[model samples]
Target: MEQTKEISALLQLIDDPDEEVFGAVSEKIVEYGKPIIPNLEDLWENTPNETIQSRIELIIHKLQFTDLAEDFRQWNVAGHFDLMVGSLLVAKFQYPDLSTAPVLHEIEKLRRNVWLELNNYLTPLEQIRIITGIIYGYYGLKGTEVSYTNINDFLLNKVLETKRGNQLSNGILYLIICDLLDIPVKAISIPKQFVLAFQKPGYSTEEADFASKIEFYIEPASGQVFSHKDIESYFKRISVPALPSYFKPLSNKKIIQYLLEELANCFDNDKEHYKKEELLKLANMLD
Candidate 1:
């Protein structure tokens, strides 16, 4: 009761003309964290002063960013290298209120649909075809080639909702569903593009010969399977010499870092300097 009363008193001073007093009050309110958000929101709704409303909004954003930073730190320490969780955390930077349950449910539905059609008798290519049919044909998810630079293309939740995304977002979704279905699809970070590789059966990532174990590459945007020759040709076309690291499957942590780098690029294009810096900091945490 006393804490609530104190919060109420602090809320009253949010409109104080003195800048130092308002800053002190804002600091105290922020210490209350996420639980104080609803109260701040209520105050914003009721207050007639635009300045106070802006201050309240800033306080809310600060608290949310604090929570996001802690979540990212914990995710890095846990060391499970969960791709879905990392992608969701990246999404949370843009959408602080985002929930992972619905996103997981959507991915699970795709996994279940693909799982029903898969069997030991089917070849790896056939399995990929089935998944492609379910995701691209039946579900109507497509590549956002025209709006590729849009920041929304990088957010998993928005991609799931819109059924359109750039290479990385769609590729991540494809990888997560394949993972859930126990398929051997892995993300391969090539120059200027994100693609997937089908690992040969019994090829373990722990093995030193992991790079040689990739059977073929799959382009998630178009469900097209291509060979090493095709990758070579692509490198030639782009005028960049191919490196061994480009063919290697990226760990989930590295995949998240790549996604963050892409997101920072998006923010930079939009001229959102602070957001770009924040994303870069989060990306470095994976290191």
Candidate 2:
């Protein structure tokens, strides 16, 4: 970061034509971590060759990604996994310089708006309707079907900024709000679908009857509500047996891992396949 003699030498050799030498230099530069980013940026600006600039950019990305991977490791080992923080870390994968304050502010605004409309006596259905109304109707957040071509749909910050996201990202946003409000809504593993369920008060999936514990199912994409019968029909359509494990609420860590796995699908091209590997590595870290 301070541009010591070693750092300077490494920066100079960043243009080395030998693949082995460049790779070695890149590894050492990445070891300096995020603090060394500004130096790399300055180097990129002054360098005339586009090839050298691309090399510098790759080094800078490695530095940021190295830092982000550690953050993911810490999040995995923490006593509690926070949904909002986990989602933000995934966003940082694509946007290293993302400002979290504005995202937090937007979330706070939505939370406060929904909170104001809530009361102690409201039924679970009423409370969910209020959240759905405020989020989809008042805030006008739009949910699109998941598409790997649109990477923005998988990011939390982008979702809040653009008011659009795919099913998984939208479901995560819904989970974060429900968590803050102390509601029992959770994302359940519904097989190729991102679905939320409203667990009845004092009901646990550990109970013998899995379906009975859920008051209703929610479609995160459009804030659409469904009954047990609807979910049954879905299982029948897919020809998959409805198992209790599918009804269990996903942990925050698992949800973020799923997000990363889904996000990796967006980078299947020749130039960006490394990103897919990196994202899958991050997803495996959560395991």
Candidate 3:
């Protein structure tokens, strides 16, 4: 009852004309996080004052963003980094109300389709064919070639919804499905591109010798599989040195960092400095 009285008192002070007083009240309200959102919404609905409504909206955004930041920090410290969760965190920046159920359902549907066709005797190339057939042929997911610079192409939820994304988002989705199905595919940070590698049997990603066991690479943008020699040729054509780390699989944290960097670049290109800075801050957290 005392807590209820305190909340009532705070809601009454929200309409104070003084900016400093309103700021202090807003700070106190936001400290309660999402539990206080319904109360704020109720106050906004009951009040006709535009000033109070605007203050309520700002406080709601602050509380929600604070909740998301805490979630990201918790995910980071939670033992193994989850790529799907990390990708969804980036998605939450645009969609604060984004739910994981739809995303997981979509991924699971794709995994089941691929799983039915996979067998223990299948070669690595055959496994790639099955995954590609389901992802690109059946599902018809294609790369967003025309609007490659669009920010939506970098978000996993958006990619799943639209069935079209840039290389990075598509690659992350591909990696997630493969990981779920116990496939040996992993993300490799090739220069100017993001792709997945099919690791040879007996090689674990955690093992130090995993780099030498990469069988081949697959471009998720179009589900095109290629050999290591092709990567070397492409590197030569681009004038980029053939660095060993380029072929190695990236950790979930590194993959999320790369996705953030791409998001920052998209914002930078559009001259949205605030969004760019925010994405860069998230990227730094992964580091």
lDDT of 1: 0.85
Output the worst ten-in-a-row residue range by lDDT, candidate 1.
266-275
In the order shown, the candidates' Cα RMSDs to the true structure are: 2.6, 1.0, 3.3
Q: Summarize candidate 3's per-residue lDDT along 1-287 as a digit string, tens digits.
A: 22498899998999999999999999999888798898888889999989789889878877887887787788888957989999999899778899889998999899999999999999989999999999999998988652536878889999999999888889998998899998989887787788889988787656665447988899889989998789878989999987776777788999988787778777665545656777788788777
Which candidate number would show the highest lDDT if scored against the true structure?
A: 2
- Which ranges in model 2 have alpha carbons more than 4 Å from their true place? none
The TM-score of candidate 3 is 0.84
Task: Give the worst 10-residue stretch by lDDT in candidate 3.
Answer: 266-275
Question: Per-residue CA lDDT of candidate 2, range 1-287, in tens?
Answer: 69899989999999999999999999998888889999999999899999999999999889989999999999988848999999999999999999999999999999999999999999999999999999999999999988999999999999999999989999999999999999999999999998999998888656767677899999999999999999999999999999988988888889999999999999999999999999999999988
Backbone clash tally for model 1?
Answer: 0
Tell me the tens digit of each residue's lDDT in model 1 across 1-86: 23477898998998889999998998998888898898888888998888888889878877887898899899999989888999
Candidate 3 overall lDDT versus native: 0.85
Residue 6 in model 1: shift from native, Å?
A: 4.4
Error of 1 at 195 (Å): 1.3
